[model samples]
Target: MTLNYYPDKPNSESDTAIYLFLRIGKETIKIKTGQYINPKHWNTKPDKNGNHVKRSYTGSPEFNVWLDNYKKDIHQLYNKLTQGNVAISVKELREAINSHLKKKEPTAVIGFFEHFLDYIQITSGERSKSTITKYKVLYKHLETFSRDQPYKLSFEAIDMRFFDLFKNYLMQQLKHTDNTLWKDFSILKTFMGWALDRGLHQNLTYKKFKAPQKDIEIIYLTEKELMAFYHAALPLGSKLDKVRDVFCFGCFTGQRYSDIANLKRNDIKGDRWTLRTVKTDKSYFVPLNRFAQAILNKYKDALRPLPVMSNQKTNDYLKELGKLLGIDEPTSLTKRRGNEKLTNTQPKFEFISTHTARRTFITLSLEKGMRPEVVMRISGHSNYSTFKKYIKISEKVAEVEMNNIWQMAEPKQEENQ
Candidate 1:
């Protein structure tokens, strides 16, 4: 790709518009640079370096500098668009150039919130519903912060100062945990990156801004608890009963709630389920276990495979079901806010949600001596970093079991001795 400046009417004596000539392969795009010059000072012939503006003109120095910067901006935009082997059409290139030029003027640039909406609009089709919801939540928090603090939120206003202020706002004002703050920061940075790629703003300070984050405890039912919940009697066709069946299906199959909710009769082939997961869009083959198969047989005549409710409703019902099942062991969660550690303890039943079924499956599968690779395949876990957490939980369970066995055998050995 090449970019050069040319006069609209090179032979005219009066001032004429300077148009940007962008040539990519066989295609050429013309864009008005919004800079004009008299044709008398314009040079139609290109210099050795392909520069067209004559250096002998009165405004030649500044004009040349402007052209150089314009060329640099065009190339930067082209490189950003083509990075990662992305192919760009001539129309896309033109629109990108126009968007970049519009953003160059401070008055023409939209505010941070406006650009964020644009980001959502452009990415909504590619993102999941839950992800889009999270983005909107972040936007709301930022909006609240801007309003309460009476602080202007613009691209130029996002820096270390804003980071510190936002952190304090989330932690102190909103009483949010560090992990929540970290997620908001992460989302903010992602938006900034999207804006940067579009030439919306050149603020790089958000990149250096960091927030504290620590892993939260994973909540899952033990084997005894899972079995108890599965067997707990509710009205046969009640909401809780249906929720239990769906949740237990996930527990038995290690599939995600989204996948379970969307599972159809056609997805079940022979003794295995072959379907693409909702979150990752990856195909998974989950062999039918006795428990999973039984649950499916119970719902075989339903419109869908399982009587799955909305995720929010399912989570609410799960907590209610857990309470009924007496899964109320106290669970403590630790979080950080800068240098301070905050901990909250609640009944384990309160922590149970649709996702808990997935964690329960992974943890129980590992504790039951299922091979890690096999478990990962069934669970559709691609990232080792994420899968390693369940492995650690299983290891702790094994350590306790081994200690108990040693204690019992040591007593016999001592008596024999």
Candidate 2:
């Protein structure tokens, strides 16, 4: 085997990166060394004038030392590959070289994904807690997928065929809907792209693969249901009562649960809540309606409108509150996976989470003749298309709206006719 070092391409700095070309018989494989210096510094022979030109890297002893150490490491890797007269493919050789160079990095796909999760937390200080949680779930799904593999996966294993197998695994084994599958695959693609950017992996099959997604069926409480929940009797000052008030406040104000959970006394201005939103950084002034204002008045002596709890706990309490209020109307849900159709029916209250409050606000507001633009202001939705999706209109509400429009447009019969 012969190892020749040369530049793969010329960079704008006129300095080119050096790579190792391994020639075994007629087969040659090139591997990047991730080192670069000026062309003048890389010459190993005399000039055309027949005089020896001093190496430029010699001027920097620190750089020279690092270069020497890297070269020695490469030599060791080459020896390791050839030991025991074992035949090594170009892929194995490259993997060995990279594993040696990056001492602590995981060579398997699973290990790299774990490393990536840590990297996201450390590097992405701006990511929200909920956003981080989604990535954590994505990692868990990857662990499940790789649990049955005979050998650990590498970047090389993530090709077009792998995507097919993974999609099947998610459908058959995990029983994931198109939406869930889409989310998982999208996260995987994002991580793979991030890896590519950092030179950790070179697989680009994910680029050709498109994640499956269908329009989500938005479910929200109607005006009657909202009123019923508002009037539901509960012992005064109980935990459920307080949580119900907070949830009702969200339904009226169209604010996110995170924003509502973090609502401070200072964020209130006169009859309006004014501040920059936590996630979007956009300024908003949401005028409080009677229902929302009443909830605030109940906790007037406190520093904030409601006692704080973790989002998960709040959601758990909300589910229990839904059950207590008899909001157990059966809600039918359906989704598609490839050629198969899947369906389920459950109590609507079982699906009541913090997000439902925002949806309720949007849907009920639209049902009560509020303009879409006005509703968007309170909901902090900058995109009209996305704002439209959040409003889940019932067939009754749609019929009522059409009748109202038709009645207004009706022509009066001429009295003289």
Compared with the true structure, all predictions reach lDDT values of 0.85, 0.74
Superposed model 1: Cα runs more than 4 Å off: 1-107, 411-417
Q: How would you encode candidate 1's per-residue C-alpha lDDT over 46-128 as one tens digit per residue?
A: 77765666764533555677788888888888899999989889999889988988888556556789989988888888776
Question: Highest TM-score among the candidates is held by which one?
Answer: 1
TM-score of 2: 0.65
Error of 2 at 261 (Å): 1.1
List clashing residue pairs in candidate 1: none
Candidate 1, residue 356: the lDDT equals 94
Query: What's the alpha carbon RMSD for model 2?
Result: 14.4
Angstrom error at residue 247, model 2: 0.6
* lDDT per residue as tens, model 2, 1-417: 765566555343455677766677887777676665555555444345322222443233444455556556677778877889888887788788777768834465555656667656864555567766778887776666654421134566677767887888888887888988888888778778878887887788888878778867777887888887788898898878777887888899999888888788888877899857766767789999888888898899986668756778778888898888788999987799877888778998888877888999988888777888899888999987677565545446788878988996668878984
TM per candidate: 0.69, 0.65
Query: Ten consecutive residues with minimal summed lDDT in candidate 1?
Result: 408-417
